[model samples]
Target: MPATLLIPLYRDEVAPRFDLAGEALLVHLDADGAELSRSSVLLAHASSEELCRIALEEKVRVVICNGIDDEFWQYLRWKRIEVIDNVMGPVDEAIARFRADALRPGDILFHRSDA
Candidate 1:
């Protein structure tokens, strides 16, 4: 099964916000990770509640987001959905970290503005 990525729509590195749900949900069958279109990320419009619900319904194994609200994070944790917080990178790089085991469930990755 492919790992799923949940991203914010408005951020530079995040996938583009498209569709009524407003987020790019990349589901690829590569353990190494897959590249996604910047125009297809639509996470900005969806609230934490909505995203959490989406993750659950989609059976998303992983979520890489710019930031996470406390309530949403807690909910996701309860659901056993791994979250990579404060992630800053291209979609592929983040997924690489996950595949390499360099990224942890509650990791606080830094996406520098300079990067």
Candidate 2:
């Protein structure tokens, strides 16, 4: 199965992006460790809302990121997609941790917006 990881891109480990919607999502195929960067990234020229649309259209299964708005959290949860928040450390390490099942439904996460 595939996982959707929503990561808030920051110069360092702290702080949110200038735009609340201006976040990057790294999608990875759990089994093979293959990343879907080129085919999935929709922030090159589109608005954040558009990118969110793309994620839903692409059937994003998981979202791993630093932080997300309460609205998007509810939307994703309503769609039954898994989400991970407050992610730090290297992206590779995060992925590995997820695979090891060390991460829980709300381990690195908070309210699902729906809650």
Candidate 3:
């Protein structure tokens, strides 16, 4: 099946904390792992439960964020969503690494945005 990746977003970068993010980037990757579409969603509020609900509602298959709480992490995993946490960088770069299968938890791909 094709997979959808959700990334908690803060401004132009990955949100530092998942539960605190008020917006998210939803990326749909085709069966071949090419991007099918990308959308940004603004939430009514930020919370772990809200994030989970949105993910489930959107049928997201993967989640990539900078930091996530343990309970939320476990919950997402339990729901069968692949969670790649602690990744820090510009949203585009992170997604690039993800598509290339080079993204890992705690990876800081971009050191500066002004470069």
lDDT of 2 at 34: 58
Write down the TM-score of every candidate.
0.62, 0.61, 0.93
Q: Which residue pairs clash in candidate 3?
A: none
The candidate maximizing TM-score is 3
Tens digits of per-residue lDDT, candidate 1, 1-115, equal: 4566665444445432212235555554355454432224355465667777777876777777656666777778789987677665565556567667686544434467785
Candidate 3 per-residue C-alpha lDDT over 7-105 given as tens digits, one digit per residue, 9 for 90 to 100: 999999999999899999999999888999999989898887888998999999999998899999999999999999999889999989988889898
Write candidate 2's Cα lDDT for 14-115 as tens digits. 124313534454555655545555232436542445645656876777766555677776777788867676664455556667767676433433225675
Candidate 1 similarity to native, TM-score: 0.62
After aligning candidate 2 to the native by TM-score, how far in Å is the CA of 43 from where it should be? 1.1
* C-alpha lDDT of all candidate models, in order: 0.58, 0.54, 0.91
Residue 41 in model 1: shift from native, Å? 6.1
Q: What's the lDDT for residue 68 in model 1? A: 64
Total backbone clashes of model 3?
0
Question: Over 4 Å off in model 2, which ranges?
Answer: 2-8, 11-25, 30-42, 45-48, 105-115
lDDT of the structure predicted as candidate 3:
0.91
